[model samples]
Target: MSRSATFDRQMLETAFSEIDAVHRSLPEATLSTLAAEVVTRVANNLRFAVQPDMVPCLDEIDMLCNALLSDDPHAATAFIENVQTKGSSYETLCLLYLTVAARRLGEWWDNDDVSFYRVTVAAGRIYAILRILRMERPIGVPDMQRAAAFASVPGENHTLGITIASDLARERGWDIDLFVGLTHDALVETLEQRQPALIGLSASGRRSMPALTRLIVALRISNPNARILVCGQIAAANLALVGLTGADAAAHDFQGAIGHMERLLDLPTGRLI
Candidate 1:
């Protein structure tokens, strides 16, 4: 059965008002990034807040991902529909299957297991599915005081980690803007325009530290209020590394990221409900 909306319309309107204020102030170089992030945070959580969904197996995820990369435009959509018809919930198809498939696609790109173009095409399908899923969900509130953006170091060849981390953050109720495949200047420029409250950066190895450090500095200079979290292989480094990068915290895994993110976004009243 279809459920009634579980949101306060007034609250959403108030949030949009704040977003509009930001939009009006900033030159709109990458308008879609900010808009999509807001929508995703609202759409992904509202239904999940009401009811949970099932998860798909690795094989199933691979099948759907393969379909997504097929030449037929309808293959991916058909696969999603078939899964739903088989009694998998819409929530399952989205958060479980489609989301995981994104990670898989990113994995291939990172390891050079597949061509970047192929991975990009597959990733686009996953995004399309997510957007379509949004249409079925009721308009909802973000329930956070500020939004976040996740990005890989400008030239980092390994980006799957940030993609996974961002999805995990969104799963845990963050409004997240993702910056991938951007040049150093472009990433910094787009970030300045978005002005996110928090920024998550991923670096696979020590080789990326210089670029990573530079990025944190640029972000700090440009977005003074934003908290930065350093993750991926570099997070395993000692306390000295954190100070060197000037990141507020470093986390090697999901739980640590969650804990640090919470502390960063904390209010006197505690984390927003």
Candidate 2:
């Protein structure tokens, strides 16, 4: 059954208002980042506050994602029809469908069963699906007082960790600014301008450590009190190395990062809810 429209309507309106404010103030270069943060915030509010019924079971998600791996358009069509027939909540279903399902697709690439081209195509499909759902459903909005900047180290091309961390941070009501493939100087300048409460840097390779160290040093100069977190394959796989990067903590995954942030900020658990 559809949720009562009243709460979702209010939440979405509030979210859009905040997004409008962000658009009015930030540089045009940052608009895309702001847009992504707004989307994450709205989806998160829908997931936690709205509590839509008819959430897809894990098995159902696995099946749908597997279907998406195939070339047949009929599979996607059937999956959509199934979701519609079950009267699943669009916001909840699409949020999980996009994030968890995309993760599954990534694993397939890891296993060498899917090509990057195929993964990119599947991701686009999910994005398109969510775009359409965004038009039709009411999204929830939560208060965002704190901010975080997430980025890969200069020259690092890895984005999965950044995407996962961004979603997790936004879910916890932190405004997220994503920096992609930026030079260290450019990133530091952006950080200085945003002055977020936290800065998260991800690197898939160890070679970027030198530049990452410089970035961290620059961050310390610009925002002395902001917590720094190092994540992604290198940091998560090598816990001891995080200290060398000057990060307060290292996280292998989303929940770990959230826990680290909570401890650093001295906020109680479940603060976002």
Candidate 3:
């Protein structure tokens, strides 16, 4: 039998409470209808739940997504507040929203229900929220002297996946360096100079495969012992393809990436609770 994950009841309650605020003004019939729609959407698509017990229900996730995507001036703030109250850590929250929440909006856009303008607006709001949250906290000091570097494969415009992983690594007291928009040559030069203990590379699609393979080859030549992990939309789906790039491993998500980092470095993993 599968073991039950340890889940904090208080965290689930807190999430529900925040969601309750949004439902307070709706009539019973309206609330029921909305809840049904939320469940349907979640069921029809892929949803990432952090823990079986603590996972936000369909209604709660739907509420949060609506708040972020809606035109209301206060909606984004409310969504952030809900996440802040329910999420265990900054990194975890970022991963959850980056994947689940963002994907939900993208699905709507694909159906022509959500416009490009609204999607960009919601993304900006999330970026601002993350900026404020990270800035409010004191800079982290590395627990171990080892350092890690993160960057996207050349030609991939989206680097947020690695950025989120970097933030989590920084929080865990790992020396983290993030580079964006770097060509393969530039990345190789930087990696050679840093010779970090670990390196993470992100690639968004199959088009990045060739450049990624070249970058990985250069990375191995520069720092033969550095633990390399490939991550991103394509990495999560096609892990075997990542191995063809000569990396040590490919992360399925931010949380899985952290676990791999701990294992590769011989460091103890942190408990989510």
Using lDDT as the measure, the top candidate is 1
Best-to-worst lDDT order: 1, 3, 2
Model 2 regions lying over 4 Å from their true place: 1-146
Cα lDDT of model 3 by residue, 1-273, tens digit: 121112233443333333444345434544433333332322233334466664556676677667766766466565555566653564455444434665666577668786655554454344334334433434333345546788888888887777877887777777788998987678878887877777888888777765675576456444545778887777766536532444677876887777777776666668433
> Residue 247 lDDT in model 3?
69
Cand. 2 Cα-lDDT: 0.58
TM-score for each predicted model, relative to the true structure: 0.45, 0.45, 0.45
Instruction: Supply candidate 1's per-residue lDDT for 185.
Output: 70
Q: Residues 3-66, candidate 2, lDDT per residue (tens digit)?
A: 4212233333333343234335544434333223222322332334434444556787778776
> lDDT tens digits, residues 114-196, model 1?
76445544543444444335434553333455467888997888888788877766765677888888987799879888877
- The TM-score measured for candidate 1 stands at 0.45
Positional deviation of 236 in candidate 3, in angstroms?
A: 2.4
